[model samples]
Target: MKRTEVSFDIETIPLTIRQFINGATIYDSSCSEHAKTLFVSGSERAFLKISKRGTLEREYHMTKFLHQHNVAPNAIAYESDLDYDYLFTEAVSGEDGTAELHLENPRKLACVFGEYLKMLHSLPIEGCPYGNRTHELLNDAQINGIDLNMLNEFSYSAIDNVVIHGDYCLPNIIMDHFSFKGFIDLGYGGVGDRHYDIYWGIWTLNYNLKTDTYRDIFLDAYGRSNIDDDGLNYFTKLNKLTD
Candidate 1:
């Protein structure tokens, strides 16, 4: 299957803010043309996420699945049109957990984040209908003219299947202090090997910190003594070749 190139944006809808705030104000932030996120609060807080081309539907379904399993934030409402999709969910307290990590001790943050990934990987996957993504990703890479031999070195080993946040990065995590509150951006959520999450966790840490030490700390906290050298090699090669 050909992968669709999707983009994201966020926008604020014209909703009365006075009912919720003593001095109600509206703040809207857009990351891109197709994605917009709105924060509204005075007494009550909620987030309005708008996306184009059915992105919200995919995210909504994934969020609902996680909520059903008692994972994180609960969905409030969702609506869509031919051109846009909207999802409203209870706002998580605190800012992006990554922001906190960057300013303070990242090693400790890595430990906490590592444990969260382990817990996430422990979720049951017997009933999930998603495809085995390790294979699927490799397949997609190959179809896109990615080198197979360079990709095969990755562990690709199937640990007990569990739900994977396909894009498990720090910014996607919401937390207060060291305590993980919830997760967002589930467009790629599905069942897969634990390494899929682990691999990306390391990748994200490396990307965020511009250092490899935190990656080691994360692996240690994750109880992994040795990195999946093969997997890392393949993914590194894959990352370079794809770019």
Candidate 2:
């Protein structure tokens, strides 16, 4: 109820959309402390997210960019009104990677997760607006009320950057049966170091599966040669400050 008050004031939604969603089955799908996400199902399937004003601007733009690349959902609308930001998007058709089917087969799940991450990293960053994530991450960590000493001060200048799903966790990955459908919850996605994504990919698998058994399998599937142990470790430390 507090989330409804703080993030989503139902009256803030446009009238036509509000009427439709009021009649549809609405499910609370929030996963972060910063926002509220709702899944609406009925005549049309869609997701509506609300957060503090101006907070969803980047997600709106990033989703639009990735949609052009065929890897994200189409962003339908974005509006900032009455101290809240609202974003509407058509839903990607599939269950997330954490679904029982994917969870039952760890080996297959790890492979698909690794392979698809590799594919996302291979995307061209030519028109990406969020290419300065490394610099931004450092700055964000320093001033975001987190202890600066907790962050790794490693120089990432020499590493090649790629289009990364900033939050490359299993829940953000959608799978239709065993195949990768698309990605969701891409608020932090953009051009960044590959190891950052790899770090999350490995972490998510271990966290979701409740074991570290698939770490090497995931790395190998993502092309072991491209992985840098030091980079992954650096990101592991850096993530604490951001999280």
Candidate 3:
């Protein structure tokens, strides 16, 4: 996540959050156009995200759920008014995977990336509330008026269902010197096909590092025996339509 120093009008902020970050350093930590994320560094470190009301409900709940499993930052508070939603979360320790320190060593980055993904997939999903993401994605694409005839032609091969970090990109996976810390931006996370996360893992490495050389290494580290080529292709096409 990028954190360029920025400022906010204290008077315009909601009273609840305004009090939370009083006299704190603020930075624009947002990566998405739909929301404004401000990082606060005062006596307490926290992130406050402001977005259209009702838009942050899933992320708020998901963050709290993942925190119980010790894989995400603790959600501090969530509030909504007539105009917007505010979600505050404690800062997780460590830099995002895109930090120069991690990106410098592509080999180790890919290995740890794959290893951590496997660790996430190993998590039990007995109580996860969002377990129908594949159908939801297809439905959302249709709702957005994107044609899905191509996706209709192929059958997605089955894999053991496991917990998935819906957007498992380098920036969302936090780490400290190659050790896993936590995952953020979990609006899309839940019980889903493992290949969806794998597809993103491969995509992020290639997109951020500007090379596809580590795709095989990542797959190997994650264990090739568990992967299905057809499943990867299925999600690739699905993502294109959804995007």
Best candidate (score: TM-score): 3
lDDT of 3 by residue, 22-63 (tens): 899999989889999999999779999999999988888888
Clashing pairs in 3: none
Q: Per-residue lDDT of 1-60 in model 2, one digit per residue for the tens?
A: 111312344576866457556656677888779998888775668888989998989988
Candidate 2 vs candidate 3, TM-score winner: 3
Candidate ordering by TM-score (highest first) = 3, 2, 1
Regions more than 4 Å wrong, model 3: 147-149, 157-160
The list of candidate 2 runs beyond 4 A from truth reads 1-10, 15-22, 144-160, 241-243
TM-score of 2: 0.87
Candidate 2 Cα deviation (angstroms), residue 188:
0.9
The candidate, 1 or 3, that scores higher on lDDT is 3
User: What TM-score does candidate 1 reach?
Assistant: 0.78
**TM-scores for every predicted model:** 0.78, 0.87, 0.92
Q: What is the C-alpha lDDT of each candidate?
A: 0.67, 0.81, 0.87
Q: How accurate is candidate 1 locally (lDDT)?
A: 0.67
Q: lDDT: which candidate is best?
A: 3
